[model samples]
Target chain A: MVLILKKQVLRRLITIRSFSYDKWYKVESERQKRINKKAQDFVKDKSVFDLFKFVTKEGVSEFKKFVQEFKETDNKNYKPYLEHGDFDYLYKFNTKEDIENWLVSSDSGYKIGKTKASLNLTQQNTGLFSGYLSSDYDKPEKSKAIYTGYANISSLTEQKSFKRENRINIDQFNCFMLKIRGDGRTYMMVLNTPSKYTLTYTYMHMFPLYTRGGPYWQYVKIPFSKFFHASHGRISDKQYRFEGLDVKSIGITCMDGVEGPFSLEIDHIGVLKDNESTEHFAYETYKIPKYISNT
Target chain B: MARRLLTLNLQLTSLNALACRRLLSSASNDDKSLKKVEKTEEKILQKYLRKIRPKDEEEKEEEERKGPFKNYFEDEERNKSAIVFYEEYFDKNTKQKDRDNFMSALEAFRVTNPTKNLYLDFIYGALLKMKEYNAHTHLEAYRKLMEIFPIGPIKCLTKWQRDNMHFPRHQNCAIQILEQMERNGVILDEDFVRLTIKIFGDWTHVVRKAKRQLYWLPKFKNSNPYPIPSIEKLENMKDIEIAFAALERMCMSADNATRIEAYFTDDLEEKTKDNFESTWIVTAQSQKQAELLKDHKKSIPIFVEGPFITWIRSKMVEYFVMKTDPDPEIIEKIKQNENYDDLDQNFKNLHNMFNDPFRDEFSKNKKSDLSVHELTDGTIFALCCTGTGTKTSLFYWTKILEKQISELKDFIIVYKIKPKPSFLVDLDKLKNDFKENQQKSN
Candidate 1:
């Protein structure tokens, strides 16, 4: 019996070992890397799924040209975040400068330091906002700024855009901070050159508003048509690209630009770029057909 | 006697010769024509040499006396295919270990003669269940049986599915099936990914749990790296990292440190804390700020971790000492909590930490409960008294602070519970009296 059982068992083990499989080892980070590679390959692979890939080189350039040349609206506050090359960063300034990311509520009411503070010395120089100044440093130029600040907000009285300029020329591209009331977080929008300047580019330099904080996680979407119409001075159905740029990422300016008596906290900042959204690349791609038609 | 003896001897010799020839020749013969005649003639002397079972006559009598053959396999054929059958069934029925041992007997039997279906089924089921089914050694067995029977992956998968009928929808069935599928060379495909996604569906819910279980789940060797990413894959990976970390931490075993290096997605290479810490702190600070502003609460403590809290406590102490007899209760509370432990070696962060103690204190204590106007009033009051305050005579202090804080244009009347003439109108006097009053009351 012992011999029988032993023989049977030994035979089974040896037999089973025949089918025993060896396992291949894989780690997660490696897997993630592979996933990314596969996705990229799948996206770029001509035969597989390249139909949905982002716009390529010529497409980007042409879109920029169209945005610069043909925008359709002039409403001043149609703010937008556009992609650009590298990114626009301003010169760091005095730590104690009284600037804010965007305006929330200032206790009694009204946006203090909401309007760009002009230099008492001359019309040119104004209080600093967080951005690079042209040689016109002391000389005031109307521009929306992303600045650091120190104020515990009571509420955000206003979320609507304020008119910045009637006519916006594509002379400059900028990246700035926006202190929105929803969640009372600082939002950063990087505006590349090919933007609908009059409306899409207004809020960055437009004056501030005060309102109670409500609708914490809500996001607002306005018609892109209105945005296009704002590029012409005020209200004419103007078309302007104000073009030229590429942007890698749009996020909150990494540094704490506001150094008042207190540390100004910043929340996340990103652009909601998607299909149908008018990014520089998207605009350029649309313009190619136009350029072809003209020729 | 001689004539008679000779005649008898001749008869005996002839008979013996004939009998011997028949015995030797007809051992391989077909018929028994001579056996019928010989049996009637009573050739009983050869009865001892006839073929019989290996039982003793007495034992057979005893067995017959006792009962019929206890089992057919216990008969004379015990050494033949009967023993093979008995060995396979008994080994498997008794214990797993025993079945394993009987495999050789079964093999040896097969080597001698192929066992029929009943015996074959017994051996195969036993081997498969014992999880001892081997491809190489049992390759012949596997192949032979497969040729005889068309049940492979389906049998195993179906059995598991039947067993776990109530196993929470597709969760366990999918697992068991896929595992078996992997066992067979189904070739891992998107179906496996789909099954996983189907079982867990949206990554949002189980991203954490699956990430953890994934550490234990055998990971295939593949990687993903790129500039831009897939929307779908991104959705899948959204919360997988945390889940992965948790899985890694939980799945530690002796050899796991090595084995799970593959499962753990965390980079083995060291990352500088500088970038990560600053980002974390900034993110947390901003989150806190958002929470405070939207909710109208204190913004500083959003990132109030141990070090930050400790710094705040120490700053509170400094602020307390910066003036004479600062609220003892507040100082005492800080001392008791010992919120300060191992912290910034130096006090560089003091400014951000409790720099505005009165406002910070009021924000903590009041805004959480008060209406907007009440909150603003307390803040304004604290600000004038503590804002740029100097340690001077109490009388002058009250006069200065009172003059300043009274300018607030915003007001909401709050019902005070003070006793007769207990309240002081002068904001600065109010601060002094309130402190003394709180101390006395406590």
Candidate 2:
């Protein structure tokens, strides 16, 4: 009797679940149809005149209000710590020894046994930082071996010179544009930010170089907003904004797990003001939507 | 209406703020002086707004139906008005943006009204003007004009020559247009060829100009024999047939070769010779001999002659066999076969030869050294039928045969096949012969 009663309850629960699922399916289909109709209507009504008409009086007022709110929130919440008037050359690698004074080598082989990496400054055709990395997966414990070669800007030696009178103020500048050439490989641009605690984290932005037309020099701009907070090479949940952080050092790391020779040529690194720079955001994740829907 | 007024007020305030920022940034000073300057700027902006308010009111009162030019680009009748505006003032417009807009509008109109030849003359005139202007946008304008109204090569060449003669500063533009037309599959005519020879016949001048204008000719993989064939070299040819063959040998595509041949043939009163069989045989023989002497160190004297079609087929078969690293024993067996007529049987035998495990091992070992595609009997037979092989395979087997004969100290004798007499005779002759025979019987 108890088993039959339980069977009857199970049948009732199954019927209820199926009924709810059918209702949800009907709602989803209807929503999809509505969205399709909206898309068709949008395409049909599209014209150059409609674009002009969108820049109406109400649109202008709304834009002004948004800008006003943004400015107010920015001023109240986050104040920049460093302020520098002029954008001057903080580090220039014109001489051969400047490389040693500015950069320190770090490789994954230091921690792992089977990986190999090397970094050298060669002046054959042009002065360039050549890095080679090879990985061996035959290591006993590890399932996969990742070889990384990095040249980090030394904070201990360069911090005094950088902070003396030529500190980079993130509020005034739009981006740090680096003139570099690379064999088509993805590399990471790392920035170490000052923290109140002894243990500080680094902000990283990974970008790929496309020199398909041949290895030619190109300027890669890294905007302040593109950097994401990461502790010990792993991303953290707490996000770091560029408004109030003091940047201690900058570095380049090659860690795409592609075990082969890699080289990057750096010509000049300089900060450009917001008005002087053409590109505002280095990465698309920080891109602002150009259009806003009225409805 | 209230919302519109509020929007206008906000826009004015933002504009005032921007202007104040620019002024302050340019002349930043003490706070008190800055305040004084800001107040003066605000007063000036209000006065300016008041002055423009009367004009805005007048414009509102007029309430004229704004033409396409009023919005510049955004209007329902933009296409029509833009066409009219371009037709009227295209020559006078000096701005690059205006020219770009005119070309874009013209393209849009052309797409909508493809059959309308009414505006072609105006577009051509504008194209001429743009060529004279010689700006970076001229190429785009020329491309659009050509796409809309595809002129014949003769007329295009004439126009190019005239343009170059008139404005020597931008002669490269004319060459660029011609190159683009050629890329777009425009067949060159006799007049066009004559004009090109007349203009670019001076090899020295063409080479000098080519240094600056790299797009004048298509780039080839290796060193080109005649990058731009001079008229003197082409004039020595017997006919368009030889000229075309020469061009083809110089790595020109069949399409380009035929196009050039047609151009030269059009000017001649006599028709081009359709029967190039004898000439082709001679040319092929000489070419094969020259290639053998240049490439191979061993002196190999080759003699290749047959009916033109048969000769080409045999050459293809030879190339297909040579490309594969076939077994020497199998090749000897096939060559010594008595039945030359049974080609399909011979091919099957060749296919069966590869089934041996030793041959497979040989192929496997050679696969590492040979980067070319692995040879299969099916592919070889297909290549034989198609008469198409890699460029290096041209007459490859003929050279191999010559090398073998030279090494063996053997001479190959080939006999020409003679044509048989006709079987049909005249009916009148037959009747006369019958009458004569009857007389003889009497």
Candidate with maximal lDDT: 2
Tens-digit lDDT string for candidate 2 (B251-289): 222112111212211232234555211211111222322
> Per-prediction TM-score, please?
0.15, 0.26
- For residue A209, model 1's alpha carbon misses the true position, in angstroms, by 17
lDDT of 1 by residue, A16-44 (tens): 87622111111333578999998887767
Query: What DockQ does each prediction reach against the true complex?
Result: 0.01, 0.01
In candidate 1, what are the lDDT values of residues B318-398, reduced to their tens digit?
Answer: 011001112344434433332222235322211121223443353244222321111100111111111112232212323
- Which residue window of length 10 is worst by lDDT in model 2 chain A? A207-216
The best candidate in terms of TM-score: 2
Candidate 2 Cα deviation (angstroms), residue B166? 86
